[model samples]
Target chain A: MTETRISRRFAECAAAGRPALVTFVTAGDPDLETSFEILKALPKAGADVVELGMPFSDPMADGPAIQAAGQRALHGGQTLAKTLDMVRRFREIDAATPIVLMGYYNPIYVFGSERFVVAAKAAGVDGLIIVDLPPEADDELCLPALAAGLNFIRLATPTTDDARLPAVLANTSGFVYYVSITGITGSATPNATRVAEAVGRIKRHTALPVAVGFGVRDAATAAAIGRDADGVVVGSALVAAIAASLDADGRATAKTVPAVAALVGDLASGVRTARVGAR
Target chain B: MNTTPNSLRNGPDDRGFFGIYGGRFVAETLMPLILELEQAYEDARNDPSFKAELANLSTHYAGRPSALYYAERLTEWCREKTGGKFGAEIWFKREELNHTGSHKINNCLGQILLARRMGKTRIIAETGAGQHGVASATVSARFGLPCMVYMGAVDVERQKPNVFRMKLLGAEVTPVTSGAGTLKDAMNEALRDWVTNVENTYYLIGTAAGPHPYPAMVRDFQSVIGTETKEQFFAAKGRLPDAIVACIGGGSNAIGLFHPFLDDPSVAICGVEAGGHGIDVENGHAASMTGGRPGVLHGNRTYLLQDGDGQILEGHSISAGLDYPGVGPEHSWLRDTGRVTYVPATDKEALDAFQICSRLEGIIPALEPSHALAQVLKMAPTMDKSKSIVMCLSGRGDKDVFSVAGHLGETM
Candidate 1:
């Protein structure tokens, strides 16, 4: 596979002796124009990699924050076709930062898998993190995404034991998303000690960079994760920030972009300061 | 009793798709847990002791082989309504006679036993009409596990008696207020709970729906209805019925009755879906087969009541149990394969059947299965008198009496 922007960015972060800061935002949250502004501002605000959420009506794995964000996005008339359009527009100015499309598989399945993968690739998507497709069902999406020259990232949870590590890491690329907590997103704080160990355990099986997410809310938590991992992923926290910055009518206030960018800026600083062992 | 080879039951294939339906369309966090569940169900199915235990519970606790009683009066009424032109023999595979007053106990009993075997101490279920909730509560009480049932708030008001029954059975009933406050929302909430408590919780899906092993596993458990009906029908009449019918709401009881009869080519099968007011009117019915397209929801691909953009639309039905937007994936496959005929029954037609059955046969059927009786009321009188029809009286109507009274504009 070609060295994509995701791999290059991780390598650059490794050379700088810091973990890459990964940020997540739901596409078309509040409105498409405001969401695009948030997306364009994220890179300068210090997000090394970006994951744009494709909103679906039912997000089974999400907590209230992300679920509500998706509802807002869908209510604002966001569709998969439009989400790809956002990526195309974002690529016009910034071409180096890797963009990952993350969400459930139903929307893609509805759009037709081959058609979605082709459209996503043409729209300048760097990778994918389809939450529902397991290794056991790799033929469904993971292998096809990988075949389309896009990185198919897989997640390893606390419940994923040593016996299941090989299967989890078998076809994974770009990175291994280590879900730090056992529960849903933003539900609780993860144990840094346990996360460090889980990252180490996953590294033993694959050469891919490991990014810890799901409960890494603030800078301190990101720094704690950065101390050992190759990437620090902050999703629900950023989504919650977007939600908090909304006005009474749930529309984007003047502070929406700035609030999200400020949070990303602080998290980037936290990731940069923390020292990690060299790969 | 001429049984052909079982060539039709081999579906869902290996990846859980019943001919382009029923895949694990959930989030990745639930993937490991879903895999673990698939494995556990496989082990349980292969274990003879597990089978023995489920069989014991079905017979001793749930009152298995619920009698197949010939509804002579209902048959006569059909003849009278048809101006004595014709009348098909009618029989009820009396699932309402089972403990807890519904066929839902068959699946709950099987699942709770599996839960015990898997060492899960907490049981979570989503109920529409509250029969599944009551059944889940009963099983949880019997198994000594803490239980939480997600129910739509609209249903909570409509089926208060079953709600009280669940609470009395020591299960907490959580009212879900999202997405039309019906079965679909309740299922969404239950899935959220399962994702939150994946370690110690076992989600007891009531119907033969959801992702892979669930559609297959729940059907295997509920297949007792068809297996017993087959043996009992032969014993009583020395022949299989010419036709079999059951109501479809996520299609548990219907699949249960239809599965064992799939190989019997001579035995025609029909599944009746609720047509709320009417399928012709906008947003009027829960008749997925008639008015819906194939889509994914609550983990499986099935015919769903959805808008043009694939957004799942809330299904309308007087019967809370039949108010879900999607049918079972297996039923979708069956409808495509021409193995089973799926039809719809409107609210007025079902209500009429409800009263007709109550007054004529002295049997008050649940609103869900009353849809089947409504179709039968139209179809049975047209068939020759030599023909026989067996319908699954899936539940008793005690929980539905108040809803029926309100619909009839009659005060208690």
Candidate 2:
């Protein structure tokens, strides 16, 4: 596999004093058009990385807000093809930002594991974050992803202590996504000091840049966590914010994208400020 | 709401919904398999050769066309109750008449057959009540395939008889110790086994959940219930029943009974979920669709019992079969689409129905089915006198006799 256009930019963004800004939005949200806009707009709005959520009917790693968002996307005719197409459109517009498609692994597996990788690479997907795939079955994704020059990002939770970290890292490419809590996504409370402590521990094992996610909601939380992490991954909060801008049926009735974009811009500033403060 | 096209033949449609309940809510991991299954099931179900093969197996191997006797005395007793699953045109699918003594044989047989076509030899399953395990074991034996079953440690103790039956049928039962040490744990273990053995093994999931194709496929096999009921009801009454009802666990049996008649707008479909104590408090309930959020579990995202922080919550119910944290993805889609209405039944009500049906009808139902009976009894009597209701009696009560004996004030 070759380096994705996005993953390389992520490294560049991390090299600067500015912390990486990773934004997650479910594809086919409200509708496929909005999903495309969200995907295309993230990079311009100060987001160095974007996790395009493949709308799953069941999202175990998401809160109600994200789950509802996924359901809305699915209902609005978002399929694996459409999600990849959205990524392709983003690739056409911006070739620098890292685009990672995040969701459970079953949908991808259902969509033709081999075909998915080929199409994903063609659509300009830089990395993937499958919540349920274990390192034991890395061949289901990792090998194919690597073959396509795509990065297979691994999630290491608090449970992935010393014994598991190395194996997870060995199979993982791109960067390591550190789960800040003992439980599933959207469960952990933001504890910056504790997260920073954990980040220091992870830094010793793998040279891979570590990003802490799960409870990085507000700018303060993202900034605090950014002090130790190479990147701060905020998902549920962004989905929650986008959820508010939607009508009951999940349509964006106004210029909510600009508001969402501004929020990301502000959060990006916080990450950079935190990096500076840490220095 | 009843607009989802009803397929008289089995298999998932293009959209994967078993008449608006079953659809693909999977990640990218299993898309190919789901798509392959849809095509395989569609082709096989339509082919005369395949139909004949399955019919022969059901008739000779698993014993199809189970009896539909009228529980006269039970109907009279239900005459005073609110609803009527045992009364009216109600007919037990007589799934217990099968080899493993449950309707699970229908699904296991279909899946094993499908696996054979896919050239998969090994079979892996997750069992709670052990009914599905026993069925899977029987199918693997009939097909001469290896079998593995994951059971919750707690379930292994309470359902020891079924565990023994499974082993006797040549299936290895592995006790799982994750999560709540119950159905959810078993499910996780099964998923681990599948992911580890993806090449030569087929995960024969027992419920109508887990990623794509499963929720739809399980219903396809179980759709024999709806097909049989539709034919039998018309034969008995010269018309279809006004309503059809069943207990929903992973919504498999309910979907099975509802799929055939889904296109009939005049017919209503009702599903009963495990409501634990009652509906007032969502606490301690296994009613995923009623009191759960959408979350992924056991390879598929669906309605799940989760906490404020999105941690999946283990559910509670008197019946081991109903004690699951999440539902099949199809059920979540169905709830969202308003195609089928899901109601909650408390453990007490199920227990009450268990004892009442046994004493009144001389036929005991499994605790899971008793939940459906509870709902049927709740509102049947209030229905129009001319209107008739048919509840799919998924399985017999023999296996449940032990579990409910204690709750029914009978010594085990």
lDDT of 2 by residue, A1-279 (tens): 345465576578767876688888888877888767776667787887888888765454555567667767766867788788888887787777778989876567656578889999888888888877756557667899888878889887655667666776787888888878644445557688888888888888977778888777778888888888888888777777777888775688666577678778888888878877455
Clashes of 1: 1
Cα lDDT of model 1 by residue, A109-181, tens digit = 7787888888999999989997777786688788778888889999899888888889888899999999887
Candidate 2 structure quality by residue, lDDT tens digits, B1-412? 1343343334345555434344454322233445566677767777787778888898898887766555556555656564443335344555556667777888888888888988888999999888888889999998999999999999998788889888998889999765457887787667655543556778899988875577777877888878887887788778978888888877777877888886677888788999887656656889988987665456555777865434456778888888887777656766676767899999999888888888877777888889998887776656654667777677777777677767657885
Q: Give one digit per residue, the lDDT tens place, for model 1 in B216-321.
A: 9889888899999999999988999999999998999999999998988999999999999999877789999889988777888789887755566787999999
- Best by the DockQ measure: 1
Model 2, CA-based lDDT = 0.75
Candidate 1 at residue B184, lDDT?
86
Taking all chains together, the TM-score of candidate 2 against the true structure is 0.62
TM-score of each: 0.96, 0.62
Candidate 1: regions farther than 4 A off: A276-279, B1-6, B281-283
Displacement of residue B81 (Cα, Å) in model 1 is 2.5
